[model samples]
Target: MDDQLAFRADDQPSSTSPPVWRVLAVDDDVDFQRATAFALSELDLLGGRIELLQAFSCREAALLLARERDIALVLLDVVMETEDAGLRLIKALREVIGNSETRVVLLTGEPGRAPAHEVMRDYDINDYWTKSELSAERLLTVLTAAVRGYAQLKTVASARRGLQMIVESSNALFCSKNTRELSSKILSEIAVLLNLQAEGIVCVRAEEGEGGVAKARIISASGRFRPSVDASLDSLDSPEVAAVLRRSLQGQQTLCLSDCTVLFFPRFQAGADYACYVATERVLDDTELELLKVFSASISRGLYNVALFSRLEEMAYQDDLLKIPNRNALIRMLDMTLKDESKAERVLVLIDIDNFSGANTAFGTGYGDFILGLVAKRLCDAFDGNVLIARVRDDLFAILGPQTQVRAADIVALFRRQTRPYELGQVHSLSSVTMNLGDFTGSAGVALQDALLTLKQAKRAGHDQHAVYDSRLLGAHAEAYRMLLALRDAVEAGHISVQLQPQIDLQTRRVTGVEALARWRKADGSMVPPLSFIPLAEATGYILPLGDLLMRLALQAAKELADAGYGDIRVAVNVSAPQLLQHDFIERFVAHLQAAGVRPQQVEVEITESVAMRTFDTVCEKLRALREMGVNVAIDDFGTGFSSLSYLRLLPADRLKIDRSFVLEIGQVSNEQMIAEAVIQIAARVGMQVIAEGVETRQQADWILEHGCREAQGYLFAKAMGCSDLLRWLADWPRDRA
Candidate 1:
């Protein structure tokens, strides 16, 4: 018993609080044991709590090991009871006690006394060190590494089990069809998995309407965080939490509250159709991060399925495109508006773009598409407040504004003004388009379809203009519909003819060229002006094929004149905006010149200022190529549109036609004369000749000639005339006359 008392001290637990490690020291010499324990007590493993269990002999150490369960590390000295006693104790620990988790570090005073390699190979000790080389820091370092390894291994094992449980339970919950039930199960399972004290799940629909009012409702909760029967989850008001939830919903991101060590997972499924917020006050580790990522993906898929189901259920009441309310939505809104006392006064406006089909046909189907997209964007941009804008057809849009007809009109006016000059890429230049607005009083109780028909009538009259719906226009549309049908028939019957307008050179005084303009001749031998049928022609896309016919006629006349000793004379043809943008314009024009046996230089293609500026880069490149092939290019009515002098220099042209407005005001306005002079000087500098148009009076023609304008065309020289009149004028030439 006295000999066994040598190990009795080791069986007693140390007095340290929160025991860090229990180390058993084995030595035959009592003083060596006492000295080692004193040295180790002064050591610190990052200020760790340590307990020193002493044993004076190997037998005593073995006895102590059988009693203590938490001995983390063993510091064994060689030659304790015998020369190999420490080594024997290591074997006993492994075989008898089965304490493989405890780390054994061997100590030796004379390493040469034992076969160091053999002893290490025979025992499962962690490390071996000589007493002369041992220090407190070194011992502490070895112990810390061992203890940390043990802790990490335990944590990894525990986390693996936790993850397996989470995955299994999440799969079960996700299989449930009901969103509320699934949400509840998820919250409770996550809470249990994380060992959370409190947990809840909140689902919210973010406001996309006028005021951005969020519709929030707590769907599920568990544990102490659960709300009572009297407690309303919808009334849980915390602006910060709400903002965080909204951000998570919108962005599909997770928000972590480190203060409470809580995590909120916002699940956005089916592109933000539904949002779910899962909140838990549990400190998350690496396992939780992996679990959260997996759970969030499952939740996203579930939410998507739920949203798809809801959408299918509500398919009859939603817009297929733009994802806004549809006719059903509008009717529902109207019903709600009528029910509400606050919305007693409201205005509904039906807007239709003038000649939208004509614009679409002139540009292309692509331009029509761009206009539709622009209309949607502009409508959204203009009335972001209590307003609903929807497209009912290709060219028609509707707007609903509450109260104040004057306010609604102002909004419509602002929208038209803003969208008038909107650019539609390279195809269409900044279009000066306008919306025809028709407003109905809130008290009128008129059907929406009736108002739409009234708006259509106003659009038929003219666009870039508006008219309030009246019974008179409705009556007139019924009559005008017949005329529109007749006009379409006339266009199809080839009732249009090419009329030549001679352009005389101011310097030469002989008819140098004629512009072939279109005219409509009825079966009764009466002629109609271009303004009467051109719009109808453009709208029906008759202009494309019609323009082709006119080109053939114009080129034939030029060829006949050239064949008849008028080789130096040229014919100017005005190209429409649509024709100029056609990809085949150059090929077709060149083909016509070839068939006519006329030089490319004999045909002067005149393009409007607006058309030239809008298609500046494309037109300039095309014109340069045409001029390279000897086709003459001229800018007609240059000052009529907003063209910059810098852009003029960039244009590849043989002539610039000064607009008639400048010539008409040349004698009246000094600024007009200055502008004309500037244009002439710039044209001359760039090696381009200037032709003044609309010179009706002698004073206007004289002012233009005095300003160094090289060419003039107007009544002052000769009014535009038929091909026979041009031929007579050319035959009796007055070269010196202005």
Candidate 2:
């Protein structure tokens, strides 16, 4: 039979009375049941009187157990209805009724029906005895211990359930993106753990500033407390609840009052202290109080992690020294603004400090940096905190604001203001034009490039320059970028050809050597001047392969001319500084001549004097290796560069090719003639040959020879031509038509 509430008293106690323990007795003998009831009926077991329940058969006992909530003990008879009928009831009680918490004892009139030791050991029985052995005192003692064990197990299960709730709630709270979300979750989870109503308020305050919790406010609430959401501590309607929160905010420890609980989460850096208040009618047990403390620690750790994430964001996007936005932050702001069509007439302006290097030299770097910080501060004040200013470079600042406030005229006026006496430097400023809100399409990178392009034009004009961006401004920079891409492709394809310019011995008027010049003609047969692309090639580092191609083709032409009886010839090709700095330049040079089947003696390497003057020891080592291999080295553009006398005397060179600027004015400018003569005399004293470039007239040639220089190359001899054409020109040399 399923159990009824045969008796119950004080199920939950407050020390006013002892806990009631229920016990059931199962037997088929009617007299034994009455006798057992008479013996245990008035017994005070486990500090409370027993409420003896009766069951006549195994099925009846199983029913009794299924009906009861906390049946503490079961008394059984061995031979009832069948030999194993009582044993079968135990199985039904444990499996069907699911009463594992109740203790069972076997009391039988016939001991031989079930073995005493076996029944006690094999079955889940607390004791096995004949009817003669179970006295009133022994029964009371056995019942008291079972009831105590049951109460202990129940308490353990309750604690395990609370711990499980804590683990699950922590997972949800840790994923909360902000404090507001975390506040709501904390209140709901604590209510669930305590088996109370989902009603509480989460309040937080910055650490005990100005005393008490006047600044504290409720961030989240639910149930009856929902109306108090966002209410400050001073505005709380319930004075008792407000006092509890104030105590928690000021104190470092959690408080479990007689009618409520306030959890105090301590302050972590970048975060405020949080106090969560929940109402209850009675004080919690030790287990509940301990669980809340553990829950508080776990939630506090999550808050600390959120604070750390926010701090890392500041470090990433804030300038370390200027205390302003950095380039990354500026770009992020630009992207956000451009993505929103509702934004107003805003423009990006770049301000650069002209001659900034001179400032670093005039003042020490320490003072220069201090001046830059001052500039950042002044710009912020001048804009009246209305614009977003960024330190994009050491000496360059960018501003994003309404175009009316950030106009070029205002920036120029600010720079020229007489009261500004710090003397930072002449400042150049430019603002990008306002693009069409409905039609403009580009990324933040594109917008930044436009601002930078305008700044470049302003800076190039002079100091204290100002301009507004236009479509036509700085078109050359964009065009140069496009041309660099094409040049890289052309050099890879080896499309540039070499032209030979004859260098004639002045007195003999005979061809001695030829200078190889690189020439580029596009598919349309339009020539790109060397002035346009040569510097572009050097600046973009395409000169490495361009240098290699020129050398390979120059050597091939030299081989062809040698085959045509133009023997003992040297063809000179220019090498840039970046190419000369390569560790493998000398190795590659030897490999190129060997691959072309041309002798090293037929090649001449021309490095500008400016390139040779830097890193004297390194350049001398490479040049000496070249001369050792029977290759000739000449300093190209001789007088136009560093003109270091030690460079000339130190370089192991074969000739100094006088720059064309000095040679072109040789007859017209007396100073040019003197410089050319001085170069010729210096070449003689240094034991090197002298070749005057750009000999356009017989008078210029005569000036060179009269100054004791034998070599000259210009239009006076022949313009540069193909090797086949040069061979034809060579056969017609010294043939005059005038």
Candidate 3:
């Protein structure tokens, strides 16, 4: 026979009362079970009564604990069907079942079978007493103390477990950087935190009228309510769930019922609130209710931070004016595209409006912005397939798509249609528009940079021109683009150092000055030659910044040399044509000289013969300005490509350096020596100093000096070295002793 008894004050339901404690009694003796139930019914612990759950054997007690997590105590008999049956049951309860929160007490008809001290300590038995000693009064005393201890332990354990849940839930919720992911994480955490079977729905106030909530929508849901996510709250299958959610939102409070609990929490933004309805099978105790309250606050704050982060992140990755993906996001998109093997047939295209800066000046910035948006929309509409179109920068839009769908001719034709006049505000209208485009066949590494290179070529080819990225155009090895990116990092990390190579007087064999050469040393102790990457730098616009850095270092070295009694030494630095034409380049160079405390005459700017061949007014003016400032300009590789006398006459140059090719062929070929001789004569007629480079042999030096070359540099004197090495070389100069 089984006896189950629940002792209560009255049958009337009251909200103020605590839940009753559940105690399971396991014994085959039906009479003893009833007697024990009668004894436990007479007492109360902490304003809560006890309900004695009946079980015939160990199997029944194990099943009861498995079904009920709230069971407070278990009473087991030692000598039941087996002599140690109750002892084995305690082992299963404490070890196999892992119900450490519930209290276990061992009872024995025979005291000698299991020692009281050993049983209580070893088996996790809380209380042990002989059956004969358990009188009605004694049983009441033992049960009251046991139930009180269980309640305290449960509260502490619940608090610990709840805090752990909150930490885990916060991690899951905040890891998401968008609303969609946030909703999914929030709903999943709610179920885990509540220890429910994932049956819940999150309802947010969609709109509010003067009276109350006009419409509420389900943001997220789980388990049985999962289908209701992102749906109207009114469409819930259970009217009870909907009504409780309404009450929760309207009152801005929490409601607890027999089967579920509704909680209302505030959003970060004012007047915006959300309600969570969780289905539970049993009534929650005070500990669980308080835990819920604390977790709800945590969830609210987590949601607010996530929302704020999402907004900030979007701003970081998106263009502000055009509201499209910026350069950084476009690069990430290209990287992702490269990772996808299926996108092998795709092409990356860069579109640039021809003379856009001119248009921006003529039409004003507002009109320019309107035109950008118009172009973006038209490009999106023209591409039939799914494509990623981004405004990388001002008047520059990039698109990635399959070659089968987007061909180069198709893009040119589409933009050609945009050339038709557009009537703006009936007064101001665009009479015509033209675009330059560059495309690459592969969606692989550095596609944007490749497209950019092609775009530059297009611009050079004139308006409305387009070209495909060809590695042959790069004029470097196949891995040149990768090396370019690495070079940029090297510059920023200060890996580029200036090395000084001595220029000697050819006749005296004495060092005249040093040339500052840019040398790169990587982390793995490998050296990158300037010839390998200088062309890439020039093409990719890195030369401007690189030239500025070298100029500053060269100035500093020149200052140090002048202070070290080598005051007559002049440091010559190679300057690219683009660097000379950059805005404010002269001003910044003057500032660098002032900062280094070096006079303008102590430095020389070296330009290639090819640079003088191209005539830009700004470049010519800047060169003349440098000469006027007492800075010397030298035409490097004078006997090399485009050695035109007209260019030499037009450029404001004070020195001409004979090309290394002529010097290297001095003994090998007669024409090379004659070319070197003619270059020196031209420098004399033009009133410019003459220097010869790559004079490695005694014969080459003798020939250059015989031809009236004033200075020469070669490995015969010293390779490029650091400042310390140069100082040592200066002290050990053979010319000074001679």
Using lDDT as the measure, the top candidate is 2
Tens digits of per-residue lDDT, candidate 3, 464-583, equal 666766666655433666686688789889999899999988666667779999999999989999998787777655676778888888988998899998878889989897777656
| Cα deviation of 366, candidate 2, in Å | 12
Tens digits of per-residue lDDT, candidate 2, 290-319, equal 777667666676666556544544545666
lDDT score, candidate 3, position 164 = 49
Rank candidates by lDDT, best first: 2, 3, 1
In the range 1-738, model 1's lDDT, one tens digit per residue, is 112111123466668555376777877767667777787776665347668898888898999998886787888887766878888898898899987667788887544334344454467776677764565645655676556444433444455455445445656754444556666666666556666644445555444554875454555555433552123334555555456665655554455555332233332333343444445554567787667666656665555554544554344344444544455456566556555555536655666655565675578656766776676676778776688776554456666666453243464555444454554431221112121222322322233545655564455555454555565554554444444455546556877556566566565565666667776677898886777655544543445666677787788878877887786777887777667766678898899888988888788888888889876888887788788998788998777677887888888899998877777777678754467787788789988988888878878777777778857777766776666776787787674465
Error of 1 at 549 (Å): 2.1
Candidate 3 wrongly placed segments (more than 4 Å) = 1-173, 176-195, 203-215, 250-253, 256-259, 269-272, 281-285, 383-385, 412-445, 476-738
CA shift of 7, model 2, Å: 42
Highest TM-score model number: 2
Model 1, residue 409: C-alpha shift (Å):
7.3
For each candidate in the order shown, give its overall lDDT on alpha carbons: 0.63, 0.73, 0.72
TM-scores, in order shown? 0.45, 0.58, 0.42
Clashes of each: 1, 6, 0
